[model samples]
Target: MDSSTHKLYHEHDFDSRQFLENYFSDKPDMVFGDDSLTFLIENFRHVFTVGHINGDILIDLSIGSFVHHLYSACEFFKNIIVLKVNNRCIMELKRWVDDRTGAFYWGHTSTILQEKEENSDQFEDQNAKLRSAIQHIVKYDLEKENMTDPLVLPLADCVLSAWLLDVISKDQDDYIRYFRKFSRLLKPGGHVILIGVLNITYFTVGKDKFQGFPYDEDFVRKALAGEGFIIDYCKVQERTAVSDLIDYKAVIFIAAHKEK
Candidate 1:
């Protein structure tokens, strides 16, 4: 768990396309993934399907640089600001939002979300709306006093982080620091949507290996409680699919709100 062990944030080294393909290529066995896809949809739906989550702004802080996490969020948030650690990942996400060539197909994810919403099977219209809701895609420095740097945006109504802190942080203590930092991005009483990947230390994309933090359900519940948040809903999806692509025990979906 040494902070020095993480070198995945650099450009080109992370392989954004490969990362998406491995986890979200949409072939079941849970999409060549463990319960990752199932947990992703269910967790996101936990927020978006709720009437209280609708707001004017959402801050999505993610490491994988995929838009699928926001498949359910787009309709609820009028403006979305995506925060990224690497320049290449920022570019990769932008290409998809701009409808450029070579972007990974997230239409499959959209369909799943649409079905959850009880909406009609209209992929194109929904995808367009998702792209449009995202108004800003910018660089983020997690270790800084201000994550967005030189532009401290207004505190958002909700912060969406999926498999971010655990993958990026070096150890347990650093993970706690990152959690507090995330709270600063929100107003008091604002909500946080979290996806926790359990009991794994590393993952592979193509031939490249990335670091992950091994954590449990108790660690997550305690972390949020310690951070001044009330656990509103927490669901655990056991990893039932076998995949040589990555190793993880389970995924925990948490929807918590900061105490007023």
Candidate 2:
């Protein structure tokens, strides 16, 4: 397999709609199942509910235009700043934020969060709150020293990313370098939460395959430790969804805070 053929996410024009339909949609046979959705939502709810993790500002650097993971965080953080590597993803997310007619439906995810929280808020209201909490959605450049250059973003009290590092990094050294840049957004002693798929080498969207950097739990532990972060919670779940769209073996979630 020529790794060169596997494009980094930002290097190619992505099919955002196709990507959402294949993975994030609520279809019964979606590549990522309801269990994965629940896993992400429940874990976020628990981490934020623990009291210490909640903060005034949160920086979100997740891959794609997905906002399902933010339902729980909206309640904890006063504001959220989303950074994206491409304008396509930024526009897709803005459609949802502006309540456009053809935006991706995320009501099911809202239902999951409501069920987890034991609350019965209407889906519209839940989504509206999330939209309100989002302070800005800006495009970024990975090669730049300050990803969001010309606009120095305030250091956030917490940084959260899902399935981003691997897709954007070409190798282990790149992974660590990117992680260090990511962590620089966090205030000292602030927390970071990461959601990743283990052993996934590639994923397809609309016939275009993108590369993923494969790694394991131990590597993540060491990566965080080397970055001066102390892990507080970690969980892994065997792949529950049956799909060929991606070859991930499992999913992992980690919560940690900078030791400085």
Best-performing candidate as measured by TM-score? 2
In order of appearance, the predictions have TM-scores of 0.91, 0.96
Clashes of 1: 0
List of clashing residue pairs for candidate 1: none
Alpha carbon deviation, residue 90, candidate 2 (Å): 0.5
In model 2, where do residues sit more than 4 Å from their true spots? 122-124
Q: Candidate 2: count the clashes.
A: 0
Clashing pairs in 2: none
Model 1, 1-260: lDDT tens digits are: 34245445433378887777777777553354336565587667776776368788899887777887787788688999888887778888989999999987876776666666554665558778888999999887876799878988888999988888778776788788998998888977888988877887777777666777788999889989998999988888777767665578887888899999
Error of 1 at 213 (Å): 1.1
Writing each residue's lDDT as its tens digit, candidate 2 over 1-260 gives: 45679877978898778888888898876857544688898889889887468889999998999998999889889999999987889999999999998999998888877776544754558888999999999999998999999899999999999999979887779889999999999998999999999988998898788999999999999999999999999989989888787888889999999998
Name the runs in model 1 displaced over 4 angstroms: 1-12, 27-30, 121-124
Candidate 2 global lDDT:
0.88
Model 1 has an lDDT value of 0.78
Which 10 consecutive residues of model 2 have the lowest summed lDDT? 115-124
